[model samples]
Target: MEYPDPKRKSNMFGKLLMAAAVTALCIIMLKHSPSFSTPTHFSRHEKGVTHVLVTGGAGYIGSHAALRLLKESYRVTIVDNLSRGNIGAVKVLQDLFPEPGRLQFIYADLGDPDAVDKIFSENAFDAVIHFAAVAYVGESTTDPLKYYHNITSNTLMVLKSMAAHGVGTLIYSSTCATYGEPEKMPITEETPQVPINPYGKAKKMAEDMILDFSKNSDMAIMILRYFNVIGSDPEGRLGEAPRPELREQGRISGACFDAARGIIPGIKVKGTDYKTHDGTCIRDYIDVTDLVDAHVKALQHAKPQNVGIYNVGTGKGRSVKEFVEACKKATGVDIKVEYLPRRPGDYAEVFSDPTKIRRELNWTARFTDLQESLGIAWRWQKAHHNGYSSS
Candidate 1:
């Protein structure tokens, strides 16, 4: 039999292909319209377990997020260099999960490309919650190189690794340090980000890079600029068990715990001359769990080629003296406070508006009551007096 006209067949095929393309594009627009902007159907794993990579999982907030993730039924892989992280936090998590694939820990640094490569290759992660960075403002100012290398360079490495591994979603643990002394009372996401110190500068660099990277790729990036992150797991299990030998007794809440427990002579109140209700700095402190909940929500809201910048806090500013007073009341001890000069790069009064994260993510800091959160922290510190020391 003679075949039909080849040109006619070709034209028919072209018409069918055009129709399919139009249908797909219509579906895309429908899904992405303002009404469907908030996707109810989230990305998932083959076995329905969303695998997440938590860099710096042995550190303070990282560990807490990891624990929260595991509880939320996400498979977690924790990577830490142990430079500033304590293995004790990992021990606590391992004791709780006690499963191989459910929760795994890798002793690696984000600065090491080879290490990052191995991690991304082995684990099929659906998302990455990046908490690995040099976090001390004073230390970042003194050693700017370390901050740049760790925060900026290391974060870039993580980004590249995720891109290579085809992981498109990232929950970046940023800081209000990027805001750098906002002139306003409650800092909004639109506040001017003029970092005074190297730490904030490094974070700003990373944020810019991440935003720029998303411009070229299909990555979904969520940058949570955290204010003062205080409080523990509330169950006294996962708290700020910073390495005691490292002397992480400088954080306001931790210092209060130490002073109350006599671990430190007194909680040093830095900068008794700032322009605030009290002569000390004011910061918006959010519970670690609440902060991680925002992370989780960001992950849920993530879409291909999406970028979200949010200020994570309770929106209420608390002064240093007020925090000290709350600590005293929480621990039932008159914690001594010694006034000291304000360190460089210190913001006069920094808090959050939180209206964006609240309206969008439907999240609010439920456990941000200063005294109540401090009470939980005091209990944790009192129990783990040595901060998970083998001694």
Candidate 2:
């Protein structure tokens, strides 16, 4: 047999060994990555709430929050009309609840007095998280009646029902739109609301109703003024399912969807002439998961005086162009570029002060990076093409 030199043979063996070691390391890394490993964790248990009622619990943000509550051992009763929400989100909860008896779902709208009455009569909820509202600023401008009727009047009805039921605690989904164009850089909870649009006005009206109800009745209220709510469940469970007619920018998953389908040949930017580092609108985007945690904290605070308002957002403003660029990098998609005129009622830059939420509730936003949140959202969107409704 022809034998090679020992040095050459040793070199060949060493190369094979190195390649095997590298291969093993890569496998370990891939297993721990978000693609393979779950990003969500069941952190803590909720010992206080005997029963918590969630209105619009089947919707985008509501559904995820409901899931978190269930994981934390809270008895949740979801009241939804299923008008804007998906049944798939509900079904996921149906399966996960260890004891189905603890989970109750009332298929009723806040508009119906009888339905609202029935929910109040049956369940003795310790807290109520109201996510039920018609939330679309542009559409609200055109259809003010619908906005006012549903968001305002319907909220009044819910409050009346809550009062009747003696539900002492309430958490409302308010909007950063309530601020409109701010005189200052970052919007705080103390800023006097000057809503330029009907949707913002509607939210403000509902907030007023809630506050009024809290004053008159024995109710504690936490009004969460949300910025741009983006991202989805880290486990591909739930995500944004915006109304097709009212869907807008800020959510990178939807933009990624457009790129994946080749509907947008390139990134089509709406406006690029605004006064910012980039000539586009900047918004503070918070992850749906982090937002869920804030709601739980608000619910936990017992005393009536502890119930106050807080802004739920990343606190960092991300411009529209910057977000798009992040999407391109994350998804490896060449998003087309097309600049048009600026959207009416669009603020140049709207971020949160974030001091109130941290100081009051002792809760700080964990995911400050927009790209990471968007990355999670993009992956969830890629897997569930039809959104949470389809899942």
Candidate 3:
């Protein structure tokens, strides 16, 4: 015992040398690897510039919002999966804002928590405008689970990432569908959220989650429950370009445009027997330009520890027949219309009471003329007949 064990001592010394060698190798690898280096795109963030994340920036509304933010000198980063969005839209933005640090696009699905976490860790975001979702009401009815997973679960993931990263501002793109056939006219913020379809239910669930989260956190939150969004960028830069396969379940504007362009033989009016003035369903059609204006206003008014819920729509309800006539007049095409029975779960009429938004946000639907709005959107559609595929 006094002499000690030389063999044991030698073994311990050998192990120590091996450990040091391994540690040195790891350090060398880390220093030389590009993967471990800071991302160049993130390094371009200006010191005082506010960076906004647009979740579905490749889609119609999200793209317009990004354009507005860029024009206002705010840094914009668009993250879209391109599942239902167009790469062409992203390209258009990039072309418009070619300067570095002004705009960036990340092709990522928010459903992936790990990817979202990576995005948060890499970049500094001042706010998030969440618009990525499967928005087809008919598709939501047939495939309820898809809507819940895409809209509800994905929103939760984004919120968690934002909270973890301490991003305090969020502007959620909600739909008027959450009101779900309200008993009264001009649905307000107080409308009971008894959603009728899976789309509305999923959005309402997301809204509830955001509200619950906001109660304890100091995050600034704005939920814009908008009516049927129509029109385009007004500058003819962006427009609705839903996939051809989804035409049957797509928006009425797209169907009308398709019929006008002769892509379809005629447009089908799904609800003809509703108890409206024209015996068809009536809806508040808000132009995309006005909708994006509301988003910008909401962002400007956002404050930590506060929440704003507003209905972004014109306080006027237009019937299906009226909209069709406007569309025909705008396109200057005698688009044949085939009237059909009312679709299930459809409300007779759904409009919004924009008094609160007007009083608070100081925003109103400037492009209120239905024919004018349709005409502007039709101009973009006529130019991009193939819908970004032409680009």
Candidate 4:
């Protein structure tokens, strides 16, 4: 038995008090911090750089997904045709990781079989995220072959190249439009796919190809059929900056932005006689940032023996009128509304169940608030009024 020294006891008490004070401070800071929908905290990957190939990497979704990969400490190679992609956005990605051999850009079109093959020959890709395809519904309707050829034919070329190079993992960017107008309110993956538009038809054809490929070969694929994607990088590093020509034919948020900046006289409420509460179409507007997070999760969970299809959405529908009102609040201007009859190929209300992704991938849409998403989008539009050209 030994008696405790007075000095030792005093030091021990002081250390305990200091630790308690620091823990209390941390708790207070966390309580006041702004909240974001977050995944279960863990290392995103094991140690090592994953070399990923991102097709159409200069486009809005592709670029954000590439950035997300870079943040996860992956080596990224971006290939784009520049026909409808952004050069300025590519520069932003390169600047984020200036170190050599970390982020590389190749100006090539997958439509060219030779160019696609060349890319696979030169680089050893651990995985591929495919985002190259014609997405304009209006244009697809006018020139259906263009959509079919680009989405179906070009996809075969890419797949052939991947098989030749032994790249077993892929994450395909699909759209909810593949489901068309479903009788159910919140659709599940098992919902019968009956696409009504050429754009949707093109994507569905590509999906069928991917599934067939998976059955024959030891290839893993995650086809994410997402709803409308909006917002920018919350850090202001990246955002949606489409080419000027596609501005009017853009998604709802971009159209609303055009109205805010006088690019268009006002926004169009495409339908106002639906059975919904507001007599308008309801859609799931998932944030771009959160959407990309799902991509990362899919990439991590992919295996050559696995083939999965998940709908990336908030599982909650926001009406057209609600989004317009949200835009007004975000931009601090009354957005002029032009009511119009229902557009062709438009659905009344379509959202996702989102249960599979949440249960499997542990992902959530933190920035699901319409006003908040619009506000983030408005900031980017305001900063770059002419889009990347303004830069």
Candidate 5:
């Protein structure tokens, strides 16, 4: 048996007190933190849906889906407030077709009951493609009330209007973030959703509410939980606008443009030294074109029993470092990179299990790979230098 030294005991006591204080502080912070709180493995067919109402149709994914629907000769009507979506996207659509009666856009917020009523009155839409939710994970984590109000409550309003208007089918824009940190790699539709952030919780809540509605009403819904949606439209007419959170992602395109202009600062690598092969967070990123194609299918063939979930992603995973290197090769630039600590709440690896869509919808991703997709993104970004921004 040994006696504790007085000095050592004092130091140990002090350390324990400090640790306790820190833990208490953390507990208090978590308690005070603003908080907020899918689709299936299958989709099917219910015929006779012609007119489609695309909420947030002016947004990146929604706009692309709108364009695809129009090309397929489906009458498309868009409702967007131009909050995150760009008016420029609408103008581009107008310019691209230059034809009347293909698509209609209404600059209205669904949060407004009057606007919802007006839209319902104006068109006999058979289905709706909703992409109107605020999506930044960090933002939702900080301001959960905002996320709940905009995505959940506002979405409830939209659904109420849809039910009133007899719109029976819905294709929801869900997120992989709803799954939070996965227990396994390449998360599947069956993965238990344990979202760590309010944004994810809100999305999950919305899905639950929609399902609850289905139990009562004659509603057919397809929930698509998308992983990372990267790349641009192959036509160069559509692409993701510059959002504050994804500025670094935009930098890949910017670096490409700069290289094309004979200047090169390369790219910035935010984090590295993770468990991934390239020591960075790995994610499954799908091309936007492929994503839009999947939406088109969901819209075309959605049966009552088809109300299920699908993971829209390239089955393969790519680390952030790998993605940047691919961007460099795609742009033919030896991009420079600087590593920092991993971003808060960033997972070491998260990807999708896309087998359900492949087996059920007979839909598999086609067209560009990551490198090729980045090439297209680079082109579109360079072409539309200042035409749009995501605020």
Candidate 6:
């Protein structure tokens, strides 16, 4: 302003140029830095390799799914925050598939948009199998917000990344709890979803978001609504290993195993008078092996711009008393069962029709025997009494 100071203006322009040059140099350095470099072992566009992203791949079901995908020769990148997932499962997978370009584990949370965006930007994924969510029904009732954020909000983040990256296929792991004590016996795909608990409600919300997004996009989606998932990897490569703190809210099989191992005094059988064949509630116990098979079949059958929803179960319901008897026989332990009052948000009976999945995907539960399934899981439990922590 003071008679056009040319010298000051020249110095200011020089400083601005220097700052711009430094920023450019820093970006170039970061791109070439080893820590920021892209993985060289695998390429997203590699020939004859379908790179699939398995969210929450360190968890029980997700880990098993990763094992199946790796065994089937698919390139897998596992992203998990390890909140409820075990790092040992990921280590096992890495050890099993030590070969480069076979498997990779990323310790990152989907809630972080920057981290998720970076993952999608770096890897050219062909498909995404989203298995990340808090699944405990009792816990969800106590902490509804955690379920909503982890399940529904995180799913939205995954979907957003998938859309931005142009990923075409998605296989979502849903649950039959969304049916919420339907008046019917076997639940079908067309069954109305009236969830009772926060867990089921959050999962249903995610399902709705996916459905609505698919209506406007070319994404191929398969939502597998599973019943009670039990058993292990069948080959003993992976097993359910929930944290000890969550034992009370964990799976019934886990409680049975704990009692058999003397970790817990005895099993607390909640909800004894649910108007079933016996006093206990009824559920369709599907083997984890068969459950993973359904996912694989879904991935294979997914079509662009199409949405397929199917219930994955044995199409038969077993009472809780029957399951306890089976577990007792499987573990060879008396496993004292103390009857308790009904837990919140528990349905009397919930199973699957499974007709649509069988007809369209040609998938069926091969391990329909409840005792045999429990036996398979018991073997793993006995071997690793401390779960994956000891291994």
In candidate 4, stretches whose alpha carbon ends up further than 4 angstroms from where it belongs are 1-47
**Candidates 3 and 4, the one with greater TM-score:** 3
Top candidate (TM-score): 6
Per residue, candidate 5 scores C-alpha lDDT tens digits across 99-119 of 655677789988898778767
Q: List, residue by residue over 152-194, the lDDT tens digit for candidate 6.
A: 9999999999999899999999999899989987899889999
RMSD of each: 12.9, 22.0, 3.9, 19.5, 20.2, 3.9
Which regions in candidate 6 have their CA more than 4 angstroms from the true location? Answer: 1-24, 27-43
Global lDDT for candidate 2?
0.78
Q: In order, what lDDT does every prediction score?
A: 0.85, 0.78, 0.92, 0.86, 0.77, 0.93
Residue 101 displacement (Å), model 6: 0.4
Candidate 1 lands at a TM-score of 0.86
TM-scores for all predictions:
0.86, 0.83, 0.92, 0.86, 0.80, 0.93
Q: How many residue pairs clash in each candidate?
A: 0, 4, 0, 0, 7, 0
Kindly list the per-residue Cα lDDT of model 3 for residues 62-145, writing each as its tens digit.
Answer: 999999999999999999999999999999999999997889899999999989988887788889999999998888988999
lDDT of 4 at 65: 91
Model 6 lDDT, full chain set: 0.93
After superposition, which runs of candidate 2 have C-alpha atoms over 4 Å from their true positions? 1-49, 243-253, 263-267, 388-390
Q: What is the C-alpha local distance difference test score of candidate 3?
A: 0.92
**Collision pairs in model 2:** 266-336, 267-335, 267-336, 267-337
Model 2 agreement with the true structure over 1-391: per-residue lDDT tens digits: 9887999989999999999999999999887554455422211124554577899999888899899988888888888988788777888888877564457677888899987886676556778888987776656777889989989999889888888867778888889999888889788888889999888989999888777666656578888999887777888777776655444532445756566557456655667888889888888888889999999998887457445888988778988888887777767777777788866666688999888888888888887776787778778777766656456
**Which residue pairs show backbone clashes in model 4?**
none
* Candidate 1 CA-lDDT value: 0.85
Residue 134, candidate 3: alpha-carbon lDDT? 92
